[model samples]
Target: MRTDFWKKTAAFGLQDDAVNILSNAADYKSQVLEQIAKAEQRIIITALYLEDDDAGREILAALHQASLTKPNLKITILVDYHRARRGRIGESKSEGNAKLYCEYNEKYNSNVKVFGVPIKAREIFGVLHLKGLVFDDILLYTGASINDVYVQQHDRYRLDRYFVLNQKGICDSIESFMNEIMLVSAATPRIDSRPIADYSEIKLAHKQLMRTLKKTKYKEPRASNKNQLSARMFLGFGRRGNDLNKLIKNLFDQTKEELVLYTPYFNFPAPLMRSLRKLLKHGKKVTIVVGDKTANDFYISPEKPFNTIGGLPYLYETILQKFLKSHNKYLEQGLLKVYIWKDNDNSFHLKGVCSDSKRHLLSGHNLNPRAWSLDIENGILLDDPNKTLEQRIEAEKVQILKHCIQINNYDELETMSDYPAPVQKILGKIKRVKGDIILKRFI
Candidate 1:
């Protein structure tokens, strides 16, 4: 059974000292810049979107300068094709972030190449959500993209888990996937150049790309049992037969003593939520730390103009309240603990898992329906049966919980009656017409 598990996971046999975790977002930004500045061979970045804001420009400029410093430095950036061509929600139509990419390309004389990946025809259905920034052999993995709020370039910030993995073989596999699969695909194209091809013109190639991704897998090396710290990377696409989703469910099922889940959103996929119910019935300790409604990026303050998007935070809060109400008995018995994380004006984007302090998952997967059934997601599963990462894991938990307050009472969460008038109106209309059902699958 043990040998079969190792072969199925195909995890890397890495030393305990090789994995490093950062505490804050500022350090994440500095590490990215430093890695780019010092990289020798190649730099590859994969994210959903890179905003055309101050932080995005700064990072893009760093890549440009790094390529200039080392003429042979290979650089390739991948972002969602639909996201690159369109503006943010509720904004006027414009060329979007591709404009910034084009400007930088022109300034650097086409030294940097940014490819737009058409994961789907539209932005809402699915996206290019592979997370990690590679400089040479080191990988900076986070849910954050190149944005002011994500990297803490300004006063306001978004908190997310940051991990650095130093493994050459892992880097080789990621780079090879891009070099072999993505770059050569007709659906993926350079958005940095002017007069880029339109999605309509390449509809067939786009379908072919999505079909190919659904059937493809990451290049896996030989798996061996080292009886030490190790990591396995898995790609998640559709819900059926998804090895990553199965891995996540397995972690939940295999938890004997405790399980700690970190996510910005409270919406869990139906299957995981059902598993949580069983875990509680079995008397396992489950702790969930989620962001407060105000800590949501879509939150609009009372003084700000209310838009339809502002209702997102309230919708998630409603989901949390429902979960709490259903599990109120477990809460009183101290079998389940829920913490609401809030840090002034900053937002939250953290996502990961820790099972009994032995097996840990580092991922950008939201555990929500959108991520489970639609988006392209990936995660690194670390198995440490000896509890080798106990101190470091506890430290991370303390840092994340510093600004949090436990939900001892289910009534503490706001009800729909407590929402602002505009938010109430929007949510009421959506529920009245049953649009929220559709929204849950895509958002």
Candidate 2:
């Protein structure tokens, strides 16, 4: 086979191929359900949160039905142990949904198993933040978790990117990694085996997890495809020790022309921020697309006074404004472009990056301090020699840009007064907020 053919095929270990980008949650749901309907042998899912909402229940129902029909099918789901047991920031605590899921697992599908990997103690400093679905040899990866808003069951929606790859080698490698870290680890305990309220048991579990992570080794198997995908997996506090940090550095150093970044928050690590600054100084084109203040948050009314829900958005705007002020020169020139998403209501939650229009990366890691220190993040990288892939990426950029308000010129940025009255009012409120928003780096 030709090198280009091998590169594209090596990622999914498949001959025929079709890559679809689901721009909206409804599209995402339709695609996912279609995939689920076709799955035969095995289905594995790992996500940050799997709520007990309409979308969540619908997915569960589908899985249950699949298991009933396919007697030989095997299904496994892994969700964050911490988030699964607790309530959302402003929501009431209820285990009713979890109980329902358990009942479904036991009564409906004996072939399907659900596991919750609690990282509270093991990830005391961060969060377990990996999201992907594997059906047979195909992998669908994105930053979205299982929830109503993320899948757009209701009117609310989350902005995200989705990639479907049929590379056998890549899929196998990732599947093996998941099995080793989450399924076969010495600390792999049943989600409902015992209550984690016991302090001594929690401590012991943490110790076991730490020990397993320290001893685990994730090696990249060698493949000989000239067009092989350039992808790497990153862990916050697991088998990989700062491997992600090194990989990121290598990617930045290899950039040639343009760099496109998508992050929900603007709080970048010192090293990454400094590296971006250096890239700008070298005259490279950098475009950052982020969720506008009101759009880039996760909060409900009952948690604060006046039932206001803009904490996350406000925090992001404040940091972004500061970063821009510090790099005014870059803004004055044509080196940097900042775009923020705006809708009548709702927040945005997506994270990924594209560099030089040749390299693309999709990950759950936000460009914030917490992602660096707290969340368990993973991504796939594609370095296409065939310019076709680059063209496709550029098209994606155009589509995303349509949903954003651009800030490429310093003069344009300074004219905040000229912005729509609502946007100006939001910015003003963020400026007056009291202390910095603080949380566990990974959560």
Candidate 3:
């Protein structure tokens, strides 16, 4: 009854469900391939970017092979158009993932269709940031795109959270959102066969589609008495009528006792920072698990050649150090706990928030200015009214914390002076030009 109050008051939308959290990227990839291989009806995947790497090629190959055998099986993948047409940052310019898509389509006879969804005209401003992979009646949700590092196809990996749901209602809802909103709109069909030399050529078409998608909302199915779990889907774009931004703040507002959060990036929106301070002022338990500088994807050690983006890890560390110093009182009182996740040379990219044992938000939302303002982001808010997912949630938290070390004080963080020469120099230049603020939203 108390939970129902927020559902009504804040206008939170929900659906009935059942879910299981995967431990790592390797497990996630295995489960995805297994599900796709066995799927009878349809398989739909939506992500930010499906890189043209070994893991990406392997997954694509499997889908292509399955399509040839099944004949009638529907396999579709939706990735960011701009991302597919461009090379990795600092890499030599080339045709990018689009070229690979063309080769794959030609080789497979176009059985597996990969559509490109452009949320904005270019990659910098915005792109399709949706996250989910649906195989028939099952949904595997994650922040990772199909890539070697993301899927852990090699020794190096980018750590991310994976969740699987096997409920018909939720699965159907996600499928419809892809079919009706994404596919039917401005999604570029047969992208594999096209030669996209420049995004500007299709800029107008993409803008129109972006407008249409912003007005669209996924109609969540009503929860019934027999349903085992309650969850809400939050989707946002552009700023107006952004349900996700409101819901995240509301979750923070509704926290009674303790709040735990996981984010790969240290940049928090001003409002969220204020909310965190409020939680501390009220003496509530707050735990934040973020990636250490070494675990940051942008981190380049002193041994490696420096890129401008390499300074981001140090910048984030600077932000974290500032926050910890400001909240030293809470840290001493044990009201605040900060853990930096680092598993040797592996990277970290986990993102979500949990308020007590009742409210769990499973999402790709980075909870930063960029996620709040630019990208098209979505999430599932699981309200465990009956505490049905308590054990699973605790287990997931334990696995994530396994390789992390708690920060006892602000002094423990690395200072700018201690950073590598390249990083320190780039950071100095960024500060001089006030480019750090500009980079915050894009990175």
Give TM-scores for every candidate, taking all chains together and pairing residue i with residue i. Answer: 0.97, 0.84, 0.94
**For each candidate, what is the lDDT?**
0.88, 0.65, 0.82
In candidate 3, stretches whose alpha carbon ends up further than 4 angstroms from where it belongs are: 1-17, 222-228
Clash pairs, candidate 3, are none
Best by TM-score: 1
Q: Could you tell me the TM-score of candidate 3? A: 0.94
Local lDDT at 222 for model 2? 69
lDDT of 1: 0.88
Model 2 gets an lDDT of: 0.65
CA shift of 211, model 1, Å: 1.3
Task: Pick out the ten consecutive residues of candidate 1 with the lowest summed lDDT.
Answer: 1-10
What are the per-residue Cα lDDT tens digits for candidate 3 across 1-443? 14343364222333333578899989988998999799888888899888899999899999988898898889999888878888999999988898888999888894788888777666778878888898988888888888999989999889899988775666777788887777775446557886543456666766777787677666666644344356667787867767777788878867889999999999998888999999899888999999998999888878878877788889988889999999998988899999999999999999999988888888888888878888898888777777788898899999999999998889988888888777878889999999988887776
Residue-level error in angstroms, candidate 3, position 243: 0.5
**RMSD for each model, in Å, please?**
1.6, 5.3, 2.5
